[model samples]
Target: METLRNWSSLCGYFVFIFLTTVSKDACFSEGSACEAPTSPECFTKNAIETVYNCEWSMNRTDGIVTFDLYFNSKTKFEVFNKTWHTIPEEKLIQRREVFIWVEAHVGNSSCSSPRRSVVLRDIVKYDAPQITSMSWSNSSLSLMWEAPEKHPALTEVWLRGDGHPAELRKETFTRINTDQVTVANLSQHSTHWVQIRQRSTQVKSPLWSNWSPWVKVPAELAHAPEVNVTTKRLNGTREVTLTWKLRSHAAAAAAGVTYQLSDTQSSLGCPCARTEKRRHYLF
Candidate 1:
């Protein structure tokens, strides 16, 4: 019983300390507004938007806490009763400085956050860029992605060779202003994977979008496969056999490889091709 009483006293002391610290750091006074949510951020997801979507974080204290947002002391902007709120396009002047703050109400007490100043046009975050096409030529990979047609943006391209250990794989990053980029000196023997992300160059402070899904780049054929041919005459007929070594290196690294054979005077058939056995290999 004595030990249980001591533990209870210790827990009570911790609770008292937490409340006192929270009151000092999170509240200005007994009735003052609570401190602003932590790391409040506002950003526009598209270039055509004149306002931003803002969000913040708050420690959920003892009661249900509802929030109200304001812009430059204007009328409450859509009391969403949540930590995140989107300002109406016509509510504030664009391309100009605006002050943003938040108010929190719990039970009968209310608290307001310090005002944060920002320029509506400067804080922008775009959506992930989409890959349109990709092609390989002369040991180089060229990729094209879709973005704002007229609004120039800076892009980052990430490329990694296929069929390699994570630590041993070669990866490359390229920064470019155009929507298309060409990376040279890649091996034609191995396939490649690539992803892209971008941010607006016109904005003073812009956030990069999340990376796009990784796209596969198949390996291009570097040269024709070598083969051995043998022929003999038997029973007034000619028989021929052609054999080639399968290349494990290129075949395993590539998405897939296939071969084709054609003759001008004779059409060869095989069991797999379902052609006449007399004119082609039976098996």
Candidate 2:
């Protein structure tokens, strides 16, 4: 009876050891399967610099997991626990397709994300351009904006005329290769709202940037104002009074209009003008 009891106790100890080892191995295997990161996203913001920025998302797992970015046939970037990596311009050949993938490693476990293939030049997104100046000539409006880079670019312009809803009235898109663009046939006698957007022209496939802020362009004066003049003699000097009346049209007498009175003979005098140059502001 004593021998049987001892044999039973030894078998129980072995069973407990086997069960504990199996449980630990199973938990470790489960944790290793979760180390793979999500698929990566990669893009180049502009054609000028041509630097590729890549990122991936990963779930929280046990222990610290380091990442390695692999691209372009065995070229490896040691991300070192970072989710993002910037591939420099010097490491790539332009206008060619590149394959990219990321691998996560922790202790003896390793996993990889899904692979992605893309052309570096085809995935470009430029910064939004800004409108610098606006001018009017007859019935045309000229708009000038700052270029994000020295390279050529394609532009899209949106114009909204007065008395119309927020919808676009005119759309002008072209490969202007210049920062200045002129839109003809626009109404100079009516107000307008203008907005602009741009994309890289040097690339085969490029993305357009977000539209810039809307710019308010007041209506330009279409005709000269009607003036009434009265002359009076005081102290052997002639005093002249000039008064002008704007037309009844709302566009012709729009707010923020500046009326200037000037004389080529240098006869007008005011605090705002020099003695040699005669100029006066009539509001």
User: Which is the leading candidate under TM-score?
Assistant: 1
Candidate 2 error regions (>4 Å): 1-47, 53-87, 91-95, 100-116, 122-124, 149-152, 162-165, 175-177, 220-283
Give one digit per residue, the lDDT tens place, for model 1 in 33-125.
454465356788876776678777776666677777766776565454568877766766667888777777766666666677887778787
Q: Estimate each model's TM-score.
A: 0.52, 0.48
Please report how far candidate 1 places residue 203 from its true position, in Å. 2.5
> lDDT of all predictions, in order shown?
0.64, 0.68
Output the worst ten-in-a-row residue range by lDDT, candidate 1: 16-25
Off by over 4 Å in 1: 1-38, 45-47, 55-67, 73-75, 78-85, 101-115, 161-177, 220-283
TM-score of the candidate numbered 2? 0.48
Q: Which ten residues in a row have the lowest lDDT in candidate 2?
A: 18-27
